[model samples]
Target chain A: MANSIPAPRAEGLHYLGLRDDIARRIATGLLGPGDRLPAERRLQADLGIARGTIREGLFQLEAEGAIYRRDRSGWYVSPPPVVYDPTRWEGFISYVEAQGRRPATETISAELIVADPLLAGVFGRPVGAPLYRIRRRRYVDDRAVLVERIVIDAALAPDLLSHSLDQSLTDILKSVYGLSVARNQVSMRPCALTGEDAAALGVKSGLPGLHVQRLSHDAGGRVIEFDHEYWRHDAVRIDVDIRVR
Target chain B: MANSIPAPRAEGLHYLGLRDDIARRIATGLLGPGDRLPAERRLQADLGIARGTIREGLFQLEAEGAIYRRDRSGWYVSPPPVVYDPTRWEGFISYVEAQGRRPATETISAELIVADPLLAGVFGRPVGAPLYRIRRRRYVDDRAVLVERIVIDAALAPDLLSHSLDQSLTDILKSVYGLSVARNQVSMRPCALTGEDAAALGVKSGLPGLHVQRLSHDAGGRVIEFDHEYWRHDAVRIDVDIRVR
Candidate 1:
């Protein structure tokens, strides 16, 4: 351990140097988005620095959203986070494309299920009422960034599961079901990803994530859909504008 | 290592049972907000469970926001998060009081500084312009939960630094300077806590946190204040209402 230690100033420089080197590499396109970083052992041998110092530098980069770690796997450069404005009624595809990034969605599962007590309350239906539950994994530039579970009131859109579930649910609701969302009640918090969400996002369990819950209502004030989204903490930014008269 | 291994089902039960037992304790008032939990060794010895199992249970509780770790200090129960509506102009004290919690602020530092290029751009002033910088730590129910750094254009408020900064800056600007914030542009993202912020919040560095940045403007659309805030991830929930016409 003593032999591994470098002088304080030298150690600081080494870590900061590593962090800046990687950042510059990413900025210069030497390291592309989602490119895996070299293994820690390799970095240590090449940089001739302690593994602890290298880890500190990587953690700093993670804090800055420049890179992210996968459980058991190495770190990867992060893509630019998409700026999401909750005030806009925009689909994920439109926003991602607007930001010059490719977007894709994979339908994990879709089925009709009996509404639970909470779901019934949200939809103003009886507990036994039918609801279409859809789960999806959304990708930005070929890296899975979000997993969403949506519960839609089935009575409002019969055969909803028959439609291609890979596209935007908002667009599908408007085009096929003739229901346009007029309002959204959005709640968000920082959370730790667990189990299925972690697996879907290809990250380790207990990684930090952003949990967003949205309740979409039609012009008539009827609740049409409830969506629960878990996003990689580095994948998106939430923007809101408020005007007070 | 082999001695620490329990049967698979028993290990699952041990950890889940520990998690639920602690949650029940919290729900039943056996444990209160900010109350420190027993040491890991103490819990392991008392419950006759492996230390690894106990750690897993505690991590689960942390993910649920039922408790939080304090670096070298043991875990403590987390207070219920305050609901923050960024759309509202309500002050911290008003909302915290409304939710039956005490709110306090301590001015960590206040000084006048020369604006850097970033600050100059934000304020639409030259890089050498003088600005007032204020750093404050905010508390909810006796726990430090947020640290905010605010920069204000000195020309707008002549004696801004002379005023008490422990209270609401919004109220101060309105009452003293007769300037009302008519608009706010807010951006938020999940982040990892680092050096100063983590120290102020009494948590370990690299803890997950919520980072919020706000640009406040008056009726004339002049940027009045720029605020950067770091909050304990479990300390608050952000709620936004979007009306799409």
Candidate 2:
């Protein structure tokens, strides 16, 4: 076989052409972490492109974790976030640092949903009991790579919604309410991401995702939290050290 | 709102079309586990259909794990098979039986191959050292749902190829060689299936698969096996009861 191998497919990077410029500047050590990116209008004017084109490029860059944005705030360069090991079952913070990836949580949505038939039994509650459906996305290196939905019994966890949803739920449960995933019945499967999940994960629909569904309980086996994790395939691997069956 | 709403999509099994003859037979208990299925030629004579139509029916049935075929061995009514838990890192027999499914091993391929760059480190040998690459498909509910490739270091396991590839490697190592997966370093991710995997799993390419890559060793950390498990999306779950890091 020829020793020279063709380079990796370069088709998708064109959309992020300007993104490369920004990344190159960062890599060249000219711009450091926490440095702000130029505004869309200004970048467009400088680059001789339309504002919409610049906006799309910015979106692509943000999706790739090349930069970060604050709401009504500007995009900023950031370091890579930490990774969460699903197997370590650590609270979010420790796991992030362990993987040497940056980690951030943004509670995008939270709602009080009526526990319907299936969820009622799972949460060990009566039908129509109030349940907290908390939605959050995790960022690693400024790239949002995973989305999660935590369903907790509202009556039991009165302060569940009070805690920072953008932060680690594992921490909230322990520090705030003395709850833990003392025992979890977890099931993982592979699935093609739906349009909604794909958007949350910053990947295309029809791409693979790891569906981690858990029924978490207290030490007494009292059910406490129902967590659903939608994980990106590329950036994370669930490392399991299985000592027994 | 109406007391009952039609599903936005399929809630259960309605979308899965089951012909009356097939449905009735299963429903009426005329067909049962481990029973031989009528051959295409025989079914054509009995049901008065073209063989192509019969083949299509078989494909659907296979998707549902209602039927199975052996290579040149003919089709047989399927019995429920158990899913082996890679995450649990248990012996094959116990884990399978505990899941309320049968465990059957039929070794399709086994041979000694020289280790490559990556396998060298995993097997604790130099590149080009002899190793056994064994291939197996794990069945759940009589449906073959997983394809596994296991590499064994010949130094630790001389005459490895002589053992029945159909027997559980874990068992052979424990009983015959007194080795086992006392501790496993497993990394799992979601991936698309390969063409060979698709053929073995009776699914087309692009189907989702769980890639469970693992390093198994004894208490002293001598690497015994390096395994790559390609699993069907719906069949197995990677679960762990973790002590938080």
Model number with the top DockQ: 1
- Per-residue C-alpha lDDT of model 2 across residues A130-191, encoded as one tens digit per residue: 99998888877676778888899887678577676876777777777877766666666654
Give the native contact fraction of candidate 2. Answer: 0.53
The prediction achieving the highest lDDT against the true structure is 1
lDDT of 2 by residue, B133-222 (tens): 889987755677788888898888889787777767777888888786678877776655645887888765434566778898888788
TM-score computed on alpha carbons, candidate 2: 0.62
The DockQ for candidate 1, computed on C-alphas, is: 0.58
Clashing residue pairs found in predicted model 1: none
- Candidate 1 runs further than 4 Å off: A2-32, A43-64, A70-72, B1-32, B44-64
lDDT of each candidate versus the true structure: 0.87, 0.68
**Candidate 1: residue B245 Cα off by (Å):** 3.7
TM-score of each: 0.88, 0.62
